[model samples]
Target: MGKPTGFMEYDRKDNKAVEPLERIKNFNEFHTPMSDKDRATQAARCMNCGVPFCQSGMMINGMASGCPLNNLVPEWNDLLFHGNLEKALQMLRQTNNFPEFTSRVCPALCEAACTCGLNGEPVSCKANENAIIEYGYANGLMKAKPPKVRTGKKVAIVGSGPSGLAAADQLNKRGHDVTVYERNDHIGGLLMYGIPNMKLEKWVIDRKQKVMEEEGIHFIVNTNVGKDVKAETLLKEYDSVILCCGASHPRDIKAPGREAQGIYFAVDFLTRSTKHVLTGKKEGWVDTKGKNVVVIGGGDTGNDCVGTAVRQGAKSVVQIEMMPKLPDQRAANNPWPEWPRVCKTDYGQEEAIAVYGKDPRIYQATVKEFIADKNGVLKKVKLVKLEPKKDPKTGRMNMTEIQGSEFELPADYVLIAAGFLGTEDYIAKAFKVKLNARTNVETKPGKYQTSVDKIFTAGDMHRGQSLVVWGINEGRHVAREVDEKLMGYTNLP
Candidate 1:
């Protein structure tokens, strides 16, 4: 440890956020980076535990406790504390392929599992990581280093999300020719469309894309794999095909007035908003200005919708959650080093509160029906309160709706932020890969190979809908497996 008493001496100080009202005015990243000296002090708070749970990346109670990529938290913290910026950057890059994206959007699982968080605040691992990576970018430490020799074997990655990108990066480093196919007009799949510009700016993705291009990786956008480009062609042309298409089939709320005109899937809404932001075109945008909006499903996507609506000058916003509000503090069943189950006010909710008079989230409630006008345009919504009840057979708690507890809200625009189902069927069927019960491409337990020979799968397609960090983890493992299969032996880490 650089300073043994640093944890005791320094209190955790996070990067300052722009005021909610001010930040909602524009869709830009709002957090101000701390100075180098201040960030080093925060880094010094790392206790360098004997067993660093921050990097364990294990499953406890069915939730990920640490970073899925197994980022070296303590080593980099100590290096950062000692002012070794280049060394810290190298250490950060050893495991994680993209710290810039994760630092901004990741929920900071490493911090949740930190040893210092047992009694007090956790070390600012995420911020320190951001500092290290940004330092590398600013000082020209991050540059393309293409392999000197070529393996001549070509690999095809079928998606451009985090997992697909990471797999492409690793395979290209091993001298294998890599080509990535993206259905969207841009390279990043979810990163380009699913996420809002406030959390992760498009420029960050473009920056990385530039570096990957310089490293000899080929990218083909505006091409859907199953429909536009046949899977048979890829199988014949490339030595190995890796499917990284994400779990994109959205879960829908089945209710009356479902055919309303103003109703939209959360992914489609976010995608349109991002498209408008990037292209500066508003021809098909879902404009919510001066309209009352209601977002369904209390998740990250819902929060993004709330934030987006606020920025677009929505007259009002309401976020509906089926589950009851969690305790303000961790419950007794929850302990240190485990993912805390507590109430968290995200940026979107904060913006909503600032614009509206009160918090927008209505916990323990669900939409019963979508009330529409005569012309089939969404006008209002009927919501019903929920109560937790145990199932008689399984003894599992279920949110049962309470009769006679229905209410109505003025909702001109209804955004369904409910989560996604498994991978879209067209891509899976086109590849002819077997799907497990969850609808994700079935591989041998803990393996990346698909049912078809010379075909591999990773990320949401292999697993399920998950965090960006886990996607990267899946990508790295799949690359290693594909490399071994191609060369009969592998040196990839």
Candidate 2:
């Protein structure tokens, strides 16, 4: 450890955020980064525990406890504290393929399990990670380093999301000829479109893509693997085919008037907005300006919808969640070193509160049905309050709507952000891969291989929709498996 008593000396400090009211006017990142010295002080608080659980990546009480990538947290923190910026970057890159992405978006499971946080504020590990990566980029430490020799093996990776990109990066570094195929016109599957620009700018993705291209990995955009390019063609042409296609099958709202003109899936809404922002065009766009917006499902996606709507000058915004709100502090059941199941106010919710004078979220409530206008455009939604009760047969908790509690609210646009079911059936069918009961690609337990020979799967497609960090972790693991299978040995970490 750089300083044994550093934790006692320094108080936790994080990046400054732009004021919610001011930040909502533009779709850029709202965080103001801390200075290098301050970041080093933050890193110095790592503690370097005798048994550091920060990188354990353990599943405790059905939730993740630490970094799933098993990132070398202590090592990098020590390096940063010692003012070895390059070494810190090296240690960070050893595990995470994209720290920049995770630092900005990841919930920071590492911080949740931090020893310091057991009683006090945790070290700013996430911010330190972001600082290290951004420093590397600024100092030109991150550059194209193409493999000197080719392995004469061709690998095809479908989907250019986090998992696919990670796999492609790993395989390309191993001197294998790798090509990534993306269905969208641009690379970065969800990162480019599903996420709002305010959280992660498109130029960041573009910059990484440029570096990957310079490193000899080829990217083919606007090419749907199963449709535009036949699955049979990839099977025949490539030595191995890795499917990192994300689980994009959106879960739908099955109430009456679901087919209304103004209702849209959250992904579709976000994609449209990002595309409009990138292209600077309004033709065929879903406008929320001066509209009463109702967002269903109270997760990150729903919050993103709220932020986006507010940015577009929405008249009113309401986010409905079927589940009850969590406690502000950790409950008795959730203890230290376990991922805390507590209420969190994300960036979008803060902006919503600032704009609407109250939190946009309506907990313990759900939309019962949609009321539409004569032209089939959505106008109002019938919402019902719910109560949690034990089911007689299953003995499991379930939500039931309360009697005489239904109410209606005007709604000009409805966005369903209730999460995804699994991967779309078409992609699974195209590859002739078996799907699990959950509709996810069925790979061997603790393995990335699918039922079909020469076919492997990773990320949301294989594991169901999950965190981006998990996608990157699986991608790296799948690449190691593919490398070992092809060359009889692999040096990939």
Candidate 3:
């Protein structure tokens, strides 16, 4: 609970962003934090709903309706409302290990289920979380405090993304000897390479890494599990292997001339861009200077591609989403108290508007083919309009191309940000874990024991591509389960 009358007293304040014109000039984070006082007021707007569905993490229509971590939202909100910053930070860290990353990129399911959002706008739960985390770090309240006992167990984590980091944090807290093996040279996977630094500064990740290192969690960079280091060898060396390698497979679009030189996966493109930004050099990086770029997807990765392309001084940026246009207001199916499915401009769209004079997204598009030159460089794209149709068996709506709706677009470069298709092929193949119907490493929910007795899988590799918060949650939960299975009982967070 927050201030009893806070919801009546204050309307929710919005997050501030740098002007699109200014932000597009360089690849820097455009978000500007709300003042401490303002962020507190925003937190105070959390209504004292008797049900408190915002933290329930319940299934409404078979979709997650709130924070999966079930964070102590109300307690922290009330703590912040009373100007108890230190107490709020303590309450926040009890549940979430890395609020910094989630604060920047999380979808904020909690805000979607906020009671205040039913009739009007939601409380700024996301911003409030960001505020407390930032405040703790600024006041030196966030630092390393390693566990007191040594369990004498050695664990090898195969990834350094959110899930891996969360697992490592939990295991190290149990006094397990933990060494994280990151394939890339950098420790943070998508956080360092896939995400642009402006939205999330590299230093924030570095700061967290320093704290983890201080807590005795060893991180080995540039050591890939399947390549540089053998996967089987790791499984034998560690007490138990937790596969949090994440779903790195980028979904590709098949069409004529798709093998053109200018085409690349969205993950690869974003990774290369971040590499250049991190190193302060443009060599071997994906350069968009004076090139016509077409990104095929409408998700966050696609938006990130647009923003990065704009910053790289591309001639033009066009994004195509296969789905039909969304409604300006919530559809009847998505009523109040549920996450509203409505049209709203994201950061990349705002940047596109500033540079191109309009938003760069076209809805209901299907690629017919990619037209390439003799040298195998893309020159243009042939497209067709799509209409939703119901499947005969599943009854689910499928996109169908309309006859005579074909057209062509000038696309010099194509980036496929079509999302992921579950875990990669080799890691799970090495472990010989069974695949679920969705091709993800199969396991019962909350029971991460893989087909192999000592092996376990969690995060996107097991659950399918999802938000970072869920990855952290799964990793923490699996670490606890593994600890309990190894010993008779355990204490892990």
lDDT of 1 by residue, 404-468 (tens): 99999999999998998898999989999999999999999999999999999999988899999
With a 3 Å backbone cut-off (N, CA, C), the pairs that clash in candidate 1 are none
The TM-scores, one per candidate, come to 0.99, 0.99, 0.97
- Candidate 3 structure quality by residue, lDDT tens digits, 1-493: 6578888899888778878888888777777887878888888888667887788877688678888888888889888888898999999988898999998988899988888888778888888898899999999998789999888888888888888899899989988999999889888778888888777888889999999999999999988788788877987888888888888887889898888889999999988898898887887788988999999999888999999999999899999999987899888898856766777678888888889998899999979999998988889999999999999999999999999999988888899999999888888777788888788888777688888878888888888888888888988998898898777798776
Off by over 4 Å in 3: 392-394
From the highest lDDT down, the ranking of the candidates is 1, 2, 3
Evaluate residue 263 in candidate 3 and report its C-alpha lDDT on the 0 to 100 scale: 93
Answer with 2 or 3, whichever has the higher TM-score.
2
When sorted by TM-score, best at the front, the candidate numbers are 1, 2, 3
Model 1 lDDT, full chain set = 0.95
Query: In order, how many clashes per candidate?
Result: 0, 0, 2
